[model samples]
Target: MSWGLAVLQHALRQPGCPLCRLQREAEARYLENLLWENVNDPATREQWAAGLGFCARHAWQLQRLEARRYGDGLGNAILYEDLLQRVIPVLEAMAREPAMDPLPLHRRLAHVLRLPRSGDPEGIPGLQGRARCRVCRLGEETARAYAEWLVEGLGDAEVRARYAASDGLCLPHLRMTLICARTRAPQALADLAGDAVRRLQRLLGALREYIRKHDWNYRHEPMSPEERRSWIRVVAFFVGEGEGDGSLDDRGG
Candidate 1:
């Protein structure tokens, strides 16, 4: 099947956060590709060396995947040992060189390390202009592609039907879709906005019912499956799936 159709099929089957699922899958696929095929590639290693390596979350993600795949830390050691070999000298340089300004923490740190400065144009910042995550670059591309697929899929009858039937997009992706629709498909904006409203209303009703069922007056009433999971769904609606996990954004300033 075409990649778009495959993504649509997966999205339709997923109960919530199709875009999140696509992104997560894309990250996993990219990681796996790196582990199995590109770990030893010179070009890939060059990119990692330049980027100063992955952000904490992605770095740990690689180690976790490596452990699971090989049941040994061999891959992690190989990749990171090389990373350390390249990184040590730069860190030594940071330690040896004095800060440019006594208290320009950000600029001084960048200067000492010889890493790209803030607004360097050559480098993109991580959590807060800290350092760039290579995986984040991959993620942004995948997210944009999936978002475009969502916009384009709106033109197909089956795709629209599937979307209308499925749990609507999460708030973050909903925002993205609305932005895309504004320029790409104005009519879809109304339809999608209406769908989002109805979905939220439905979820609100479920949450209300869930709360009501817990009251002494209605304690005897049994909760439906939807009402039982209303709390989780409501949280996911606001936070975006997987975002609540202790990711770099959550931990970083």
Candidate 2:
């Protein structure tokens, strides 16, 4: 099979890839080091304070990591200026938005505040003790990355094909995906959604055939362990596969 096909299978089988894993670890380390350096250096500290501080989720992640590596709350205090500079603008902008149903907005903000502090044996209190969910943060980031990758890598044709093959995304992910593509041409966005729908239809048919031919039980299959494993590998290969051309590397900023 082509490298592209191989990637599809891998994605379906293993949701995370080595590149993504390395990137996450590297990002974590970089952020950690930045925090450490800022503590000792006034110039670096000022720059960080001027820039947007970590989003709620990232802040929690950093907090957790710091607590694990060093048990003091000292590091967090150094970030006070950074937090004030970054978060104040967001709060100000939010204040200016026209009034609507406040519940959803309230919930989202509350969620951010409630995010768990890293390494807290008992979860950190949310706005008022509600726990902020990390899963949503991770999902949004991953979806954003994927959407950005797709926009950059695949042409209209390939994008359509992949969309069709994909399982309809969860609502939250769908929103994130759409946001990622917000800068693209409207025609391109429509093409992508249309193609994905078509691919999904075809995939459903193929799955049905495979199930019938194998007489596989959904709940309890009769296949040998090796056979089952092989089948799973095949599925992962197809679903996770990416186009092999260096196109992915060349696409957008």
Candidate 3:
């Protein structure tokens, strides 16, 4: 089977957001590749040149990961030292640019809302945006590709069965899948979403039981393992996996 199909199959058996897990794993592999083999690679360096390396979140994540694993953080030093050499001059240049006269807050808001800037209607300066992380861009690309592949192959009995039997897609993916299915297979898509709703209702019942069983009147009752993990799963259901610290090590840098 193709890699995307393999990921779908593997994801079926896993709890939490499969797309999140896939992206997290992809990011981990990317970081490992960068640290072990690509740090000094000419092609990798070229990629970093455009964005001055990763976004702030990934930059810190990389530093923390290196510090956690190797203690030396030499990888971070090697990267950011080079990055700063590139960044500092550009920041200096930007700093040297004369400040524009402040537009009134109402005017700024109006301009942002696409209203005419009155005297300077055509060329009022807009807010400068930060460069996006290349890895993040790739992760989003791959996640959508995977989601689309799953939706397209829903005709296959094995694929449908596997998907139906799993814990169900997280909200973001469920929406994406439903949108993909809206025109092509509306009934099947509705059934899929209904199944997810029923599953969530069942989980909600278990969560209630978990809470009740913990009360003073029911202290002797033993909680099922599924009940015990419901808290974690519930949070993952909303926010996707890897939001919590346990997932930090594997999170996309």
lDDT of 2 at 176: 47
- Lowest lDDT 10-mer window, candidate 3? 121-130
Residue lDDT tens for model 1, 29-54: 88888888898899777666556677
Which has the higher lDDT value, candidate number 1 or candidate number 3? 1
Error of 3 at 151 (Å): 1.1
RMSD values, in order shown = 6.2, 13.1, 7.4
Per-candidate Cα lDDT values, in order, are: 0.72, 0.46, 0.67
Ordered from best to worst TM-score, the candidate numbers read 1, 3, 2
Model 1: CA > 4 A from native: 1-3, 86-114, 117-131, 243-253
Candidate 2 per-residue lDDT, tens place, 123-178, comes to 21222213222333343454456555555434445544554444334334344445
TM-score for each model:
0.78, 0.35, 0.71
Better of 1 and 3 by TM-score: 1
Q: Considering every candidate listed, which one attains the maximal TM-score?
A: 1
lDDT-based ranking, best first? 1, 3, 2
